[model samples]
Target: MKRLGRRGFLRMVGAAGLGWLAAACGAPPVPSPSLGSPSTPQAPLEVASPPPPSAIPSPTPTRRPLGNANVPGMYVRYFQPFYPPTREEWRLEVSGLVERPRTFRFEEIRSEMPKVTREARLKCVECWSARRTWGGFTYEALA
Candidate 1:
């Protein structure tokens, strides 16, 4: 998939933030029909209405010790379960119907390639996203 440019990315982020703020502001609760007084003088059921969105206090923002590093949410939804391979045990294999096949260890790639640090947004298909500063080396850097 084609990546979005910084300007387009920032626009999306701003729009999302505005949308969150609008949602947080919330809609006015409609009064229930049963809330009206009965002409027959029936005993009124005291149904407790939930507090307004504004009444529910929001969590205050906290300061992070590590700059631009954001941890993933506590609850994660993944399509498939897979064991993560550690750098010490993992090797990248580059083999295909080609003239030469090559294999590189994780440590080799880390030591040999030029690394890049970038601020990126991790957006889920569910419309949830988080921005963080990521540091990694690209495959192109190996070339």
Candidate 2:
């Protein structure tokens, strides 16, 4: 018997692997059936009607108001200011086994770090949420 070269051996191994895979996932082929003659249609049946009521009762009289029902109309109160605090005033402090631990302002961090924008789906505990496009620096970059 002759020994196979590197390329020939690889090709034979690949072919055997494919054959094994095919055999492992093998399923019997379905046979096609011959066309038969068409059958005749049937007629629709009619439904019966329900019976009527025997005796009807007399209607009751309406009740009168108890006391004086005069009341004043109240207006709903509205507040003026609705906007939240600015992100520029936000601060984040990190402390650990490091040479320096400092508190960073939002503007300071934004100016120092290279920002990356990413699209992600945020799911709430209530099973309702939205996809948000957020811009932030990674922990490695921050470190």
Candidate 3:
């Protein structure tokens, strides 16, 4: 086998890490006949001539323009990672060296806790940076 350099190894590891992260936050796509889902009976394949240039539809803008607040994250996703864990299943537990110990669920926390949003930059060791909007309640808020 050929020897792998540090750069090659790191690249492979980073790709794998991203793949794992994607999987962890992933869910099966909606079953469709086009996708040949196991439950769906697939149609036999047919070779057809390519459509004429005019017959093809031109690509149109289907999404709104990205704004400053729309910074993409490395592990970015608009959907909840769980599928997701129901609001009742996600718990924010507080304990140890606190006056009152309490476990709050997602909805409760979101409804009760004060939320903060600020623009911040995340600098990676790989020598790149990106602005991110951080939103969350603090420990003091929890207290």
Candidate 4:
């Protein structure tokens, strides 16, 4: 048997915990098909209808206003070590199978590109969600 490292063991435990959580929070179980005698037909199972749209509460953000980078809830996860670079030394590398390959400085990108803002909603499979206002220059702006 292969030995699992501390990180691997932790990841496996985390996955199992998530699986258990999902199982615990799952929808009501469906009734199994009956194997009753062919002579007697099983009665049709009735399902309860969901409440109307009006009865359901809206999930739109209202109580708290949208937040920025300095917001308390904002957090970062670095899978790898991060090293900050000086603005002058840093360059946006754009390369690959393209007609023209170029590297642009942070200052150049900021000054020359046309910027746009977009409202983005991030949702997870576990039902966790977040909304953010993202602002950046488009591909056309970079071109």
Candidate 5:
């Protein structure tokens, strides 16, 4: 048996380490052909054609009533007109526990003072109200 010195032992360890490293980092081996020549081309595979579309049955006709059978001659109205009273016919009366209580026509009130218009909201105690731009005289003016 031969005994290796320190330098020879180090050299042998380094060679074994390099061989293991090479084996771990080596590229994959090329594949080999088993059945035929690698350069030969393969024929394309054939598939059967799909079956023809089936004939669809026609739909049957449905019968329904056209309009209301009970009311035949009924017709709808579209427009309506609104008419207001004339200035001569307009009147306002205030009568209560007061010394200056009086009744006056619209013409007499118009002649007494200038009219004032205002916008106000009338709210109810039940938490519901409507907003409106009112055009009318105040309580003092009416009084």
Candidate 6:
């Protein structure tokens, strides 16, 4: 499978004394549903507790299930099952400090932009760490 670039990370960090809290990946970002601002306080992100050993699913044709793997395919670490958003529904919203906030569709980030492949880890305090070929595009490229 082809790789996709990372999008939306820490953007507005500078000498400006205003100090508006905004986060976009300084290098590559994995923009989720929402990253709230200070005006309306946001609850700390909540994640499910670690899954038991028995919870791990049997390997399918594509995945080995858990731990680091250099090959393609992904493992699900969540306790409950989930369906990731299809390309049509997923969006990356670039808001805050910028003069014009914009929403990027899947194609704009995955196809129109250049892609990069690198080894990276997904560390979570609530669960085990997983590694992958972190495919991401620079945040500045979107502009």
Cα lDDT tens digits, model 2, 28-134, are 76654543555555866667665445544457776433332222232234588567658877788877976678788878888998888897655544444455678
lDDT of 6 by residue, 1-143 (tens): 55443432223234232343333324566666566633654787778899998999988678554454443455555688888999999999999888779999998787777887887877655444656677788777766
Off by over 4 Å in 2: 1-45, 48-89
TM-score of every candidate: 0.41, 0.37, 0.41, 0.44, 0.32, 0.40
Instruction: Specify the highest-TM-score model's number.
Output: 4
What residue runs in model 1 are displaced by over 4 Å at the alpha carbon?
1-75, 79-82, 97-100
Worst 10 residues of 3 by lDDT: 63-72
lDDT of 5 by residue, 27-101 (tens): 987766764555644877678787655645467786333322332232434498558789877766788876677
How good is model 5 by TM-score?
A: 0.32
- Residue-by-residue lDDT tens digits, candidate 1, 72-124: 75347779999999888999787786456788898888788788999887765
Looking at model 2, the pairs that clash are none
- Clash totals in order: 0, 0, 0, 0, 0, 8
Please report, in order, the local distance difference test score of every candidate based on alpha carbons.
0.78, 0.69, 0.78, 0.77, 0.67, 0.67
Model 6: residues with Cα > 4 Å off, grouped in runs: 1-75, 124-131
Q: Which residue ranges in model 3 land beyond 4 Å of their true spot?
A: 1-84
What would the C-alpha RMSD of candidate 3 be, to one decimal place? Answer: 24.2
Residue 29 CA displacement from its true place in model 6, Å: 72
CA RMSD per model (angstroms): 22.2, 21.7, 24.2, 17.7, 26.5, 31.4
Evaluated at residue 93, the lDDT of candidate 5 is 71
Model 3 Cα lDDT, one tens digit per residue, 1-143: 99999999999999999999999898877777657545644997788999999999999868543333333656443665557677668887898989999999888888998998887876655445568788998878888
Ranking by TM-score: 4, 1, 3, 6, 2, 5
The deviation in Å at residue 139 for candidate 3 is 2.0
